[model samples]
Target: MINKDSVESAYCFLHQKYRVYEFSNSETQRDDIEFAIASYVNDMNKELYAHLAKGRKEFLCNHTTFAADMQEAINELELRL
Candidate 1:
């Protein structure tokens, strides 16, 4: 079972990786970070749905509800494009 602390730790790691990538100059670095970010989001979705399947209705990570967390991340990505 993935603990809440582990999930939160990953969230913070991805958050910092993204912030660095957002300002990075190398195209190759940006591409790598993009891939990493996509993978992290996919994993998060799996975790969220697993909780939902077990009848846990609400999930909080990185100081936000799951939906809010996703929205914030999506908004940040969109702003860059």
Candidate 2:
């Protein structure tokens, strides 16, 4: 079973990562951040993957969905846990 600490940790880690990429001004930094996010997402579980995928798709298309997505995921996860 997924624990609260684990969920929070995952959320925090991804949140920081995306926030950094989101505000990045350098193309090289963005590329590196994207690579890092992709690598982390690739190893995530189904629950986390679903949230990240949704966020990533919307972010790519409109650039303003990942934060909300992550927030929603954490809220849901915390409540469920």
Please report, in order, the local distance difference test score of every candidate based on alpha carbons.
0.53, 0.58
Candidate number of the best TM-score: 2
Candidate 2: minimum summed lDDT over ten consecutive residues — where? 58-67
Residue 46 accuracy (lDDT) in model 1: 65
Which whole-number lDDT from 0 to 100 does residue 64 have in model 2?
46
Tell me, what's the RMSD of every candidate?
A: 10.1, 4.5
Give the TM-scores of the predictions, in the order they appear: 0.46, 0.55
Return the number of clashes found in candidate 1.
Answer: 0
Residue-level lDDT of model 1, residues 15-64, one tens digit each, is 68757765789888866766665566456646533543344433223323
Clashing pairs in 1: none
